[model samples]
Target: MISIPDEIGNLSGLITVELHLNDIEGSIPTRMKELMNLQQLDLRGNRLDCSISDEFCQLKNLGWLALSNNKIHGLVPTCLGNLTSLRYLDLGSNNLTSRLPSALWSLKDILELDLSSNALIGSIPPQIQNLRAITKLNPSRNKIAGNIPDRIGSLLSLQFLDLSLNFITGMIPKSMETLIDLRYLNVSHNKLRGEIPDGGLSKNLTGQSFMMNDALCGRNPSLQIQPCVNQISQQRSNLVEMHIAYTPRLNIMIDVTSGLEYLHEGYSSPIVHCDLKPSNVLLDEDMVAHVSDFGISKLLDSGQSKTKTKTLATIGYIAPEYDQKELCLQKEMFIALGLR
Candidate 1:
């Protein structure tokens, strides 16, 4: 592991510093900004720590700067927006902190920007609408919060987007449904709520891509998501042939039975879905029922038939045998559902 010597800055005319894939330690030399002719600075896969200095923004001639896979920390210098010639910039997989600077939207020549796996906070600035040249933007696995900017759809050139594992909230911008060129998208594991947008690239996305969010609902049967109320209401409004819907009603019943079977005998250990009400049954476009809201479900491990717990079923759905304490069982859940 070599410490980059400060004396190298005296060379003055250096154009590129490709010291990546090394065990280089310690902070970058402050005087390295003297490399007036430097165009690319690739120091990826290194052990370099310390904050990125403002001097880096002084490299007016720089075009490609890749400093990923390092321990580099602190706020990204706002002056980075001044690098008009920059085309590609990657600072991913680092320990960098602070909110992203809105000034970044000014980099009209930038084609790709990756700042994922950092400790960045705050919402994506609305000024992102100006990044017309950006084709790929990854800010996933960060601490970013608030709604995804509604103007994100303005980036017509966007192809790849990953905003997973953040604290982002609110509905996905409706404008995103207009991104015809988008090929990949992942916004899972966040606090996003509302119906998943349909049409365009959204139809191509699957259940796995939007899992772990408790409130997200969609219409795609392949995605196995429960249809949102708006979608269900729309379907009902358009159901001119109500007499032909008997088959769909039977399908819902069969799906509920299948769900109960899974809970009773599917896993390595048996589970009892204690609460089985109409409200707890989610439906897809095909009217297939999906068991949901397992807030009070119980597990019966090996040698254990049933464990007693406080009664938690909805009124009128509760079995007479269930008193102050109840032993949640599959048969009881079925009986409760049958009564309703």
Candidate 2:
């Protein structure tokens, strides 16, 4: 069909058009947008290009729009933010580039939006928080970047969020652990670091899905992490050198406990690692803790700050106040303090 005759516009009460998969060619007739009452339009399997008409936004009652498998270019229209009545939109499989419109987040009634397989770049905007009503969003296969913003965890209504194959980075937000409704998430191939949350989409990822990012570590069986001990040891050594007081006690611990005490606690007597573990703390003849191991007494992270959390490596060695799943808990340090 070349499209309904212009005379059909006079009918004035049209709500739907079913013409689809008709092997149509060339640009979508601009006059088609004149059907103000048109609620649904299907122009799939076509050779459309440039971009969808901003005129489509005129269809306030329009609920579904499919412009996929086309040659659509340029950023999506900012006017889409005005489509408060739309429930579904597909602009995938195109040459779309740049960030999505900030206005599109206003589509509170939108249920599914697929802008996948495009050239979109830049960090996924946190302005997306306005999409409080979205259930599923697929922006996979884009050039988007930075860590998935923390606001994504606030999406209580999002059940599916696919941001795979992007350049997102930094550690995965600990807040994402609270997403109880997220059943599927694909943050693979990004620069996201740290462990994946225990439940939700992360729980299902094989190490393979989250592979290729050197910063990422997960409990998934598919991922195999190299020993991180060497890295931690190097950092610990740095802090030890900075620990000025320990430098004196390094060679001689005999009856040096009191001097070390003054050094670690300072003249004010601030308690360092008040919760020492069961292992015998490394102490000199005077009960002064050594700056190095065998006693595990020196604040391993011998930085200038005496009150910093003891860097531990054991799973539960961290302080009681910290949530293990969130934050960068130095469980290894916690364990070293306990073991000897």
Candidate 3:
């Protein structure tokens, strides 16, 4: 491994330096700051094992900076925010050990920011809404704590968001439902609670998105959490009191069967709903029954027929073969019949 030579900085007219995915090691040469005309600097996927020097911040024209997947340590230089022209910044998969600098959020022109897989602390500040042009924001797998700012919905241009494997708390704001451009979201393994916002990006999500968060509840059965029982009961009571026509039993039956069919044969890999009972079936406003609670579900791989599990499904609903701790395609079919 070799370090960047100080003489390399003599190229003051240089506009780009893309020495990434190499064996480059040692601290970044401060002399590189003399490259005042530099617009992009990417040294990611290297052995650069030192703290970021503040001298690098002197490049006022820098627009794209990627230093991810390295051995870089120390606090992110707050002075880097002075580069108002920055359009992209990626510092993920490093040893950075400081709270996110508030100044970083001031990069209003930044389109993508990734600070994942570090030891960073501190809450996501409300000023994050300032990144109005941002399309991707990932800060997962960190020690970051505090509530997700409601103002996050203000980033209408956002398309992907990942906040998983963190110490965050509080409810996911309903405001997120308004982000029409959002296509992917992951907040799993956090302390999030309350009803998950419905519609929009949520409609395309699955159980994997909200996995391991025990407190969340919503009408999306694929979330695999318990339904909001009190809310459902109230809705039903109101319909009866208002003399509204309830959904026909035949319709409910059809909805349940359809849900089962999708889980069994719709995908390359079949998903087995281990528990198929009345409690796990939720009725929507239209009285449509959706299969919920996939906490004990199983997904079989290609060409795989049977699998075993130590976990048991509900007593009355468990297939006879499942009593021997084995699960096969017939297991779900048997339970579905029992539900009928």
Best by lDDT: 3
Candidate 2 lDDT over residue span 173-233, tens digit each: 7777767787777777777776665556565445655666677655444445432445567
| Candidate 1 local lDDT, 69-150, one digit each (tens) | 9999999988999999898999999998878887788998799999999999888988898788899999999999999899
Ranking by lDDT: 3, 1, 2
TM for candidate 2 is: 0.62
Query: Looking at model 2, which ten-residue stretch has the lowest summed lDDT?
Result: 325-334
What TM-score should be assigned to candidate 3?
Answer: 0.69
In candidate 2, how many clashes are counted? 18
lDDT of 1 at 128: 91
Ranking by TM-score: 3, 1, 2
Q: In model 1, which runs have C-alpha deviations exceeding 4 angstroms? A: 233-340
lDDT for 252 in candidate 2 is: 41
- For model 2, the stretches where C-alpha displacement exceeds 4 angstroms are 1-11, 199-201, 222-340
Lowest summed lDDT across 10 adjacent residues in model 3 is found at: 328-337
